[model samples]
Target: MGEQQIPDATDPASVEPEPQRGLSRRGLMGLALGAGAAGVALGAGGGVVGGIALGRDQAQAATDAVAPASGIHQPGITTPVQDHLHFAAYDMMARTTRDDLAELLADWTYAATRMMQGLDVSATGAVGGSPEAPPDDTGEALGLPASNLTITFGFGPSLFDSRFGLEGQRPAGLERLPAFLGDDLDPLRSDGDLCIQACADDPQVAVHAIRNLSRIAFGRATIRWSQLGFGRTSKTTSDQATPRNLFGYKDGTANILADDTAALDENVWVSASEGPAWLAGGSYLVARRIAMLIETWDRTRLAEQDRVVGRDKAKGAPLSGGDEFTAPDFAAVGSSGKPAIDARSHVRLAHPDNNGGIRILRRGYNFVDGTTDLGRLNAGLFFLSFQKSPDSFITLQRALSTDAMGEYLRHVGSGLWAVPPAPAAGASVGAGLLGA
Candidate 1:
């Protein structure tokens, strides 16, 4: 299949046009005064706050531009992993109609498009809006740059229930994942009716996206769980150096790359023949919040740590030798008369060779969320993977059930989502499903 084209965000035909030169301080002051007047008018009639229009050329020029939102596939997955992440899952409120859900998606798409370009959620934006009324935007990201923001949306199995009348359209591969060994899942954080992944170089920018989206979803949905991550744990492109996990070992050396289009099609995007036609160019997302036992791993001997991960700490090379990208010599034996790479080591068990040549695109991050009951640093890897089917992840994870790395980690949270293909110009994300 041909790759879908991603429209340019600066294209006037694709996005709402902003002032050529951007707004000045004087222009902003005048707008603020006008907004105050509008606020008074709104307060008299109990209406939404109104605001003056502002331009975004200044903000756009301040930050790096990201991949366009419209594409064959969504941006966050293969768009060079950002430094920060704000991932959220939501449950549809009871009694929400199909129209209500569709409208929410449209609103979200519009807001996301504007934010990705360094503009506020709406033209009036935060400070320009009525002072007496609630601002349309949350105002936290007022002066921040776009920071290469990208927001990707997905639908969960629960979304296809009678509430939306989409039961017949649910993909065959969309189903609740089977429980795996060592899973200590929290029901409150595990599953949801929908999900959004917002990534940016700046943490505040990413947080702003989710914050505003959740605000927009006030009555239609409620946040089930959310996670904040920093210091990306995986590399999605060849130019980027492999990042390390909380364990201090380099991660994703063997991960699929953005330039590997053939591998991506075979392992990531769903095809029309795969079952659901609407999901033709889409992929499935699997997220796991893994808690690493930092204290224990810190005390382990260096050699043992290397053996557990099956790679050299300094060079990230396989036990059997060669650089980081060299294919592991799993068949090679060591001086002790055993396989150089331990049979149960992470590399041996998770390698595609052992799992029928299955591969996944990993976009994970390191997360530190305060502390546990014992006052231990609550840190771990927020594992994120995208593939054509959840079966790919399930198959690999099951094989790793006996992996030595499991002892140092715990699967505390999990989710599975069907990320639809990117929308065409003038269409919203998931427009294929909503028929908008």
Candidate 2:
């Protein structure tokens, strides 16, 4: 009945985790690395910037005070395996009516908070190695989530309407950027309706969160549109700590380190966007989605599939040897004389130049569900990338999209939003863009 507290990473008594759902080594690796933690940091910054409130409740009273319009109920009637759940939802915007803005935002904030509270605490903000409980160490030691929910909000040209004197709307046919053009994109809810880009560890939770947020925006906010996300199968921690994707192959063998914030800023942020007065301190565009296509992916053989991904299925090590993100010797050749890491593999597709010239911050989740008619649901990823130009993500994805592995992946749901610079103290959310 009291305010529910996140389990301490070190306090076993506080961790009331569900049963192990076959934690994949890759999944556990991804979560432990704080892959989804960015969203929490995004929303919770302003007492809960993006959509998460942590530290102490008194300090985050504004964030903790709000509850979602409806609770997120898990799908399985019986004890569900933790790894089976996944979700990735992000969005872009279009013009909205000015009169409807306030109401829409209130609903959105309320819905997001409630939905977050609805998730299994472990999945939401609490970081854990297994589904059943939190790891023995928490807090500054690991930066585990206070909940599984990870939501990020951003503004785009469409969020503002020219009719109201707002000047950010995109022209027709080009309103949304190339990266965000897709079938599953969310519609405008209102002129002032804040754009939401969210991802969860579970799909049912993600869907429920989206739907409930929609109810609030449409019913009270009078916002005109909304978007939902679908993610691809990713590596996740199962009960056994084995790594596997929807296609059953290990994923995320190649990733930047979590502590590498400086590297993230250098490699991912767009310096050009910061030059403009209105855009100063603003981060570049971030468009993301969940892609689900494990069934089609499952048809390939392990050996052939490994070649396409360029990593060992069991260990998540690069074909060249060490685990993902570890440096690979491009000059090294295999027994047949071909590069140990295929010159054309996904790794190579991303780093074709060989100086490690290209990089994008990838934060994705893994999802699976029995209720889905689609075969063996396993998908989850925030699918976020920041750059000076939309071309950064576009260029990299273009390189990989036509490759052998690209054939196995599809973009099911998508979003386009801007992540401005960190807010100054006392600055309101979206202040950098909205002018408070």
Candidate 1 lDDT, tens digit per residue, 1-436?
A: 3434654544323333322222222223323332210000000111010011113342234244554443577778888889999999988788778876776676666566667767676556787777886666668888887888988888998888989989999998799888999999998878788999999999999999888777666666778899999999899899999998889899999999988999998999898888576788889999999999999999999999999999999999999999998999999999999999999899999999999999999999999999999999899999999999999999999999999999999999999999988765445666778775
The clash count for each model shown is 0, 75
Which 10 consecutive residues of model 1 have the lowest summed lDDT? Answer: 37-46
Q: Candidate 1, residue 426: CA error in Å?
A: 1.0
Q: What value does the lDDT take at residue 6 in candidate 1?
A: 55
* Model 2 lDDT on a 0 to 1 scale: 0.41
Deviation in Å, model 1, residue 349 alpha carbon: 0.5
Off by over 4 Å in 2: 1-96, 106-148, 168-175, 179-194, 199-212, 219-244, 270-282, 285-293, 323-325, 352-356, 367-382, 421-428
Task: Note the Cα lDDT for every prediction shown.
Answer: 0.77, 0.41
The CA lDDT at 51 in model 1 is 11
**Model 2: worst 10 consecutive residues (lDDT sum):** 70-79
- Tens-place lDDT per residue, model 2, 1-436, is 1111223222223333322221223223323443211111112222222222322332232223122211111111011122322222222123434433432332243334324444222223344445675431122312223224544445555454564455643322113455432334433322122344445444444454444343333222222333443443232222223345555565544443334556545654435433344333334444454455666667777878788877777777777877644666667788888888776677667773743466555444454334465455645343544444455566676676545666655555444455444333222234444454
